[model samples]
Target: MAERITLLVGGRSTEHDASLHGYRHVLSRLLAEPDRIEVGAVCYVDRAGAFHLFERAPWPEREEVLLGGQTLGPGAALERLRAADSFVFSLLHGNEGEDGGWQGLAEVCGITGNFGPVLASALAMDKHLQAVLAAALLPGLRVPRSLLVRPGSFDAGQVLRRLGPGPLVVKPNRMGASLLTTCLPEPSPSALAAAVREVFPYDDQALVQEFIDGREFSCGVYKEHGKFVDLPVAEIVSSGFFGHAEKHTKGRAKILLSPENAATRKMRAFSQSLFEATEMATFARFDYIVEGDGIWFLEANTLPGLMSGSIFPMMLAETGRSIADLVLSAVSECGSRPARDKVLAYDISH
Candidate 1:
């Protein structure tokens, strides 16, 4: 029997809407391989903590949407709980779902996927923490020493005195998709502080990093049951630094399979190192910047977007693998959890 694959999407992050778009596109691609997939389902969690099922009756084009065990609740919409044989998550650029919070819930209920536990998810979710972790693996990569500043953590004058750096990047600790990321150049400190206030609504903690300017590029990697699948490098060209509008708005960002320069190779090397450093399983996207003689480590997306034009699928296609095949290969590995011993029904394996 084909396993039921729940494509969890939409979260309480700034990228909630964008996550939905990613799910829809991924759903379309997975349907292409009818022989392997079964019971397609969508679970949407709104900001107010309300969960809703996307479709009531499966349409002709999407006849595999299973409603048997699915239900909506405050923060989760899941069926079969511990009984689910497998799950394929596609949450992008946001909190809740991608921030390791959702992964924690999955673990509590014994649902494992490509990535490890919630600890890794939480560690990889925030750009600042991920940067600090990458420092050990990708040596010499330019990373601004930073802090996870929460509300009332510091005063502006005191912060500047502590930083003592040329410029800084003030961003929400957990938000991706560049919602409130601001480049704070010196002599105009108030502008960045103001941007910080705007981001306060989304996250209680803000990340302040020394700004490093250079060429930005990203790469993808998929680690299955002891197998690593590395795809071609893809570069992100933005009018400015890759921010919210640049990623979502057309023509603002350019994602290509091949790089125009040698810097991309350095990016791939660093990406592989960082992935191993973080102990990331399944798949992820690593972002970087190249300066004169240094390549800066930016961050990694444990759950990189798998939408139609998203970088992960693009790189996979470059390797001649269809989205359908890639998604199955990644999702199928989640069954790696050791078979439960009937004698020890509740013995947990770490």
Candidate 2:
């Protein structure tokens, strides 16, 4: 029997549009392997957090097809998913989707698939916390010095005193895709304050860190046959800080796959180490900044983008692997795991 899979995409996050774009590519890839995989449904979560179920794989080329589905409430949505008995692979990014919110819900409702462990998702969401944990877990791990700033509590003078001087990167501590992320080369008090303020609209906290002037690279890791398989390391050459525009806009950045270098080996090792240490499920991608021999840990993505032109897919392609391989591996890995015992046993004393 073909493995049934339900793709969960779109979410109440800043990356909703990106999720939709990624969904089209992933859906197309999965549909191509109908003999081996059956896409039971495409569950779409709108910006307002409502669930829409598209029973038939319409192979939506545009976003409009996502609108023509039966809207479902949370309970109804869970029931629909449970009815399919399919592995739920979430493509949702940021916030409630990637930040342990959906994972926690799936755990509570006994929904299974690729929604990673709740604690790991939550840990990966917060940049500051992830860095702290990574540093503690891996001795001699180099991460940029950073400070967390919350609304109304940001002080530029204090930040400068702590992190020091120019070329600081300020980004939403919880958001990804470089949205609302900025690098101030001449970080004045006002400039730093404005950058931190921009993050407030989308996220509760901002991470201000010293910019690592080095070559940037990202590597992906996934499990196959109960063992870790690390993909080739890809180097990202961006004109600037690899912000939203640079990430989304073609020609703004160049991605080189499996670059021959010493850092490549070190990055793959680091990625695998972090992937295991954080208890990430199925798959993950880790970004880094390497200056000479010193490699700095940038961030971790439990759910890395799978859209066309995304680094994860490119890394997979370099290894003769496709999205289908990843999905199937996830199914096998997750399916073999022990199911959660949700039942509570108790005895009433006579």
Clashing pairs in model 2, backbone N/Cα/C closer than 3 A: none
lDDT of 2 by residue, 209-305 (tens): 9999998888888789889876788889987788889999999999988656677887788788888877788899889998878989999999999
- Candidate 1, residue 320: how far the Cα is off, in Å: 1.2
TM-score of each: 0.84, 0.95
Report model 2's TM-score to 2 decimal places. Answer: 0.95
Off by over 4 Å in 1: 1-3, 54-71, 74-81, 84-93, 112-115, 259-262, 337-350
Clash pairs for candidate 1: none
Tell me model 2's lDDT, rounded to 2 decimals: 0.87
Which candidate comes out best when scored by TM-score? 2
CA error at residue 177 for candidate 2, angstroms: 0.4
Where in model 2 is the C-alpha error above 4 Å?
340-350
276-303 per-residue lDDT for model 1 (tens digits) = 7666666788887766878787777887
Q: Model 2 shows how many backbone clashes?
A: 0
Residue 34, model 2, lDDT = 85
